[model samples]
Target: MTPHQAEQVSFDNTELDKFAAYRSDGATPDAPDILDLSNNELMLPPLPAVAESLHRSGLRVNLYPDPAARFLKANLARHFGAEPAETVVGPGSGGVLQQLLLVLAGRGDEVLYAWPGFDAYPLLVAVTGATGVPVPLTATGEHDLPELLGRVTSRTRAVILCSPHNPTGRRIPRDTLREFLAALPPRVAAIVDQAYMEFDEEEDPHDLGLIREYPNVVLLRTFSKAYGLAGLRVGYAFASAEIALRARKTVIPFSVTHSGEQAAVTSLAQGEELARRLAHVRRLRADLHADLGAQGLTPIPSSANFVWLPLGGESDRFAEAALRAGVLVRSYSGDGVRISVGTEEAHRRVLIAAKEFLSV
Candidate 1:
């Protein structure tokens, strides 16, 4: 094509036109008194030790971060009982996922995931020039694994499963996941996104030996959730050496900052603090679930830091009610509402909204 034709054609049908950009609660403005629980971020601040480490690392602004982020990879591998060669660190789990998608898929390839899952999945797949196939969630808000499997085709390059799934908060049982992986064609990669894994008490995230049986499995995680390091944007994954090597090649050079890396390393060592935070979050999550239940809203039992109300068409209405009551919540229109567990006061505000919503 001629230069003018190329420019016109590209402008007329931009790659971005195929998908919607991700929008998070953090990006929108909030009122001063609003108790924002829409983002599902940890309510607690960083551990004191982690903060101190980040402070010390901040002085190295002029120097670039380790392109390989070897320090973080080593610590993460040690903490999880994996080898450094199997670890892939990136700006965040999403970034790590991008790296994986870049290496694993491209035009004519299909990457499948549950619909109403992480909003970023489609955008990320589109960036890789791959088609994103979304399987609708069961009416009960859980993954329909059989349906997902049926959608797989020869062109399918990957399947992403988000445990303690976003929005719905439903976690796939370990045995069930193993079965799914076993049934999946080995040629297709299985990405298990455990971003909220730390918030779960039933499943041990350290079951790091999963990659042994399934060479195609990639266990992805992020420090942004339970670690309260959302701003730092540190995330990593454990995979076979072959997958890790290719994913690392796709990493944006020096994307992982020095401060972020050190904070992650320091955070891993703060077991006591981490445990305490988890306990507190679990308490808050339980209370929020109960309070919402008492208000006549059936909140699905959540394994993450948030609770989901499968309100269907009432979703937007519920979110608006929460906003009016000085609380922020995420509403997946025509689907449900996901409200993060927050301070008792923020939660109380949520309960008030729930009560009002129910009475209406």
Candidate 2:
């Protein structure tokens, strides 16, 4: 008898084919020497204490990390004024988001979020076997709360809101966000992705009032952007104990390494240093925005560590020009470009590119 043919592999081929890898701003193939402003990372080194923690943890690399990440969770809880049971830690905020999606959504359920927001939202939602629905941002790059509310249906399982939204750096006002949450159905979870929260100096980064008032609301934070811990891959979330527990269950064992936990905990203790870093970032962001404006390029008013240039069809061209000028920025094809705040020298190079590109 002829050997039976292998059965076709089971997979979501369509979704897998459509998926694009997350692109971060860094040394590009054409311009390895370019100053990287593609990723919205703090252009600074880690805190002295954090670095020391990393050094100390080097000797412990041979040991397995705490699978529950108890110490990191406790530190985050203490820093954010939440109970340890109400927090979850993971490899990064992106990882924590994946955990939440897996716990709260599944096949046939729908996850809604603003388009051109965090690039990972759709990918993460898709991995959970949920349908990803994207609503467009307003012309000014702010969330259209009414539009998002109108799109919610019975099948909608979760909504991801990004403050100081990525690629645009526009924040949803506190009152506006509160109203949006109030209008959302309690059954549908609201995930407030506050990855850039610390950069908004005007806001109390540790405030958990929203989660307290609305048990369905979850806050996502990361040490990647503000803490200069991108390489460490530490992120966390705060939610109602029920949701937090469920999400925690989805975490892969020991995904957060020992070094990340120690570094993050140490960084949390450097409140004054964090404040100084925030002030410097805010100042640099302002200078970059103003300088771009002087070059006749209208960048969106940013409340985060990056600025958005609504270059529309010219986005790619501008990015190319910046690359040629020795600076790397993130371009969204026909939409716009996001330039992270960098050193004065890097900003000068970007400005040179901006002036040349506009004059052409």
Candidates' RMSD to native: 2.1, 1.7
RMSD of 1: 2.1
lDDT tens digits by residue: candidate 1, 116-168: 98889998998888889999999888899999999999999999999989988
After superposing candidate 2 on the true structure, give the runs of residues whose Cα lies further than 4 Å from its correct spot. Answer: 1-4, 24-31
Q: How accurate is candidate 2 locally (lDDT)?
A: 0.90
Candidate number of the best TM-score: 2
Lowest lDDT 10-mer window, candidate 1? 7-16
Clashing pairs in 1: none
What C-alpha lDDT, on a 0 to 100 scale, does residue 258 get in candidate 2?
A: 97
Model 2 TM-score, all chains together:
0.96
* Candidate 2 lDDT, 1-360, residue by residue in tens: 435556655787354346776654334646457799988888898899998899999899999999999999998888879999899999899999999999999888899999888788888988888889999999999888999999999999999999979979898889989999999999999999999988886579878999999999999999999899999999999999999999999999999999999999999899999989999999999999999999898999988899999988999999999988998888888889999998999999999999889888
